[model samples]
Target: MKLPLQALDPDLFARAQALLDDEWLAHDADLAPVLPTVLARGVGQDWHKAGTFRHHLIGVARSLALWQQPRAVRLLGLLHSVYGNAFVDLVKFDMATERGRLQALVGQGEEELVYLFCTASRREFTQKVLAGQIEPDGSLPLHTNQGEPITLAPDVVAAFLVVSMADTIEQWFSWQDDIYSRFPDTDTSRQQKVHWMASLWPGPMRPSGRMLHQINRLGLALQHPKLKGRLPMPPVFEACTAPFSASDDAAAASLYWSVIQQDQPLADLDVATGVLEQAVRLNPWVGEPQMVLAQLYLSAGRREDAARAAESALQAFCSWGNAWDKRVQWDAWIAWTRILLQGATTDGPGAWPERLDKLNNVALRAGA
Candidate 1:
């Protein structure tokens, strides 16, 4: 069995609904004006991961906004891949024909940033920058698909890196392990399937070592003493780059959480709970362990503990730069955690199947 279920508390539901409404309203406001243009370009109709391409685009923008990036950067993020890049060939807007139209929508400066992001060799740029290959003036050497060289000013390099970090965080998940399949890109031996279908299909699951490695590397670069004033370091970068070593425990916790998610024996719950508890202690800043611990507590009839764990999860998520699982956005995670809060505080028992159904439905709808 998974977590024990409980009826949602009515009062808690009202509070959650109000909070979510406000959050969504703010998010919508952040996307205004440019959002319409994005929709008109058929972004909403294009497929991406477990959701529409528009959803991914919006997610990237939201990440940038959460990091307190400027409006132009957020706009650049929203339209980052519209012209198609080396990674995906899904072109929502043709650069040759629609550049002027998009420039008019988000302004020339923001559109140019998007254009650069789509046309430049992002992976190569990232590698070079991380390797400290920047020019003396802090300019970045970039190349186009045709191997044409381009030079990015220091400010532009900073902005490009910020957007690149958000883009990775928005879409990377364990299910897409194939992206890191190159010889040295990832150590596949260190990765494990977080779900039954994780290796076979695309879905929400824990990120792999390859993903974390990329994130940490980017975080380190951004956190470097040199870039301090150049850009605002994303909160996730700070958390992940903190002077703490919880890698071993965190990896163990991930495996335990994965097993807990499966049709495992009941005897394994206690062991998994202990592992997760220790993992969170080592690094309370990480939300996944606390979220899983809340589930375990709820299953064991520890209502108060479950409530606290859920609250902690919410707090951690607030500062987290990306969704723990890429199948849904961070807002959806907030909604699910609120439900957990209600269930933990409520008194009546409920069917776990119903609760799981509700979550699944929300994820599907949100993805749509």
Candidate 2:
């Protein structure tokens, strides 16, 4: 599940809606009209008007409850998928999926933002989990070959677990209901088959299972506000063995921090190549590792390595998208730009002047 509140099991939507109504939403006419557009495909073949705003509402509302002020969550949840969906094709991914392409066209920072709320919502979802709130899971696999547990706050985890359940209820099960109910007692009826085919092979969703999930969550939260936040916390496993070593807050932090703070901390994208090498060894896919390594190389006056690292960091950030911590991705691009500028100032290497021009141009565009 992508968000914790999505799994509230009962009345999730009603409670979330009620809380929102009483708190921030407060019957804002300006926002209500836009709800249908966010779910414009207009439902599935079931004639259920499936993908109405209410479905996504439950998932987003529950997830945001952890950290988002009611108003902000209302806005973020409502707008999260406003641009692109089965029904709404407001944004396009025609843009390249790599940093070089985006940076060339839009410059660094703007490119990062473009990818953030656009297609990178996955990243934004995870950021909540990292901040100790319950949030959703993502395809961004922890390359910790050992699958180590990353500690997060309980309430945040609850929110994420719920969101994940809602995703299953609204996005998955509701999308293909018959397949789940197929008793498959030998041959199936053509009508049933066509009914299933028409259900999804054509377009968007049906709101069957989603409503139940919302109702279930709301009921649970209202009844047991205290127990509503309970979720089993799994321990970080040794990546190589999947063996658990029960970790408290301090131990996990110490181990993670040791590698990060080693050979000199990678403070705001200013680390040496040696430092980056260690970081990449420990956490290779991390965006900052590559960015800082690039910065470190540029500082030591190594042009080729610096360029390569810049490319890696940019590509990493872009592919991951902004859905999960869009701000951090922007910071990566800015940091790269700063390094490029520094190189040009020092007469560093090939096409330094061209790089400088592009850097300034992107900065101007991004208001950097």
Query: lDDT: which candidate is best?
Result: 1
Stretches off by above 4 angstroms in model 2 are 1-271, 323-368
State every prediction's TM-score relative to the real structure. Answer: 0.75, 0.28
For residues 1-368, what per-residue lDDT tens digits would candidate 1 score against the true structure? 23222333344334333434434424455457667677787887887765689778877776676666787777888888989998788988889999998888777888898898899888778778768777766687878866899988777787877888777767766666554553124454644555344456564465543554555565666554545567667765353365434364346436645654663456656776776676566555545667778877887877788888887776666555457655456667776776666667664443222354554542222211
- Segments in model 1 whose C-alpha atoms lie over 4 Å from true places: 1-30, 135-137, 182-200, 203-206, 237-257, 263-265, 278-285, 301-305, 327-329, 342-368
Writing each residue's lDDT as its tens digit, candidate 2 over 1-368 gives: 11001011123223323333323332444345444443444422113123334444533443344223233223444444433432235432343454455345434543443333344333333333233333233222221112343433334334333343333332433334344332112123446546756546424232222222222332233123342424322110111112212122223222333444463554644434454465444333324556655655665666666666655554443322111112222334535544553453344332343443554643322311
User: Residue 65 deviation, candidate 2, in Å?
Assistant: 23
Give residue 240's error in model 2 in angstroms. 18
RMSD of 2: 24.0
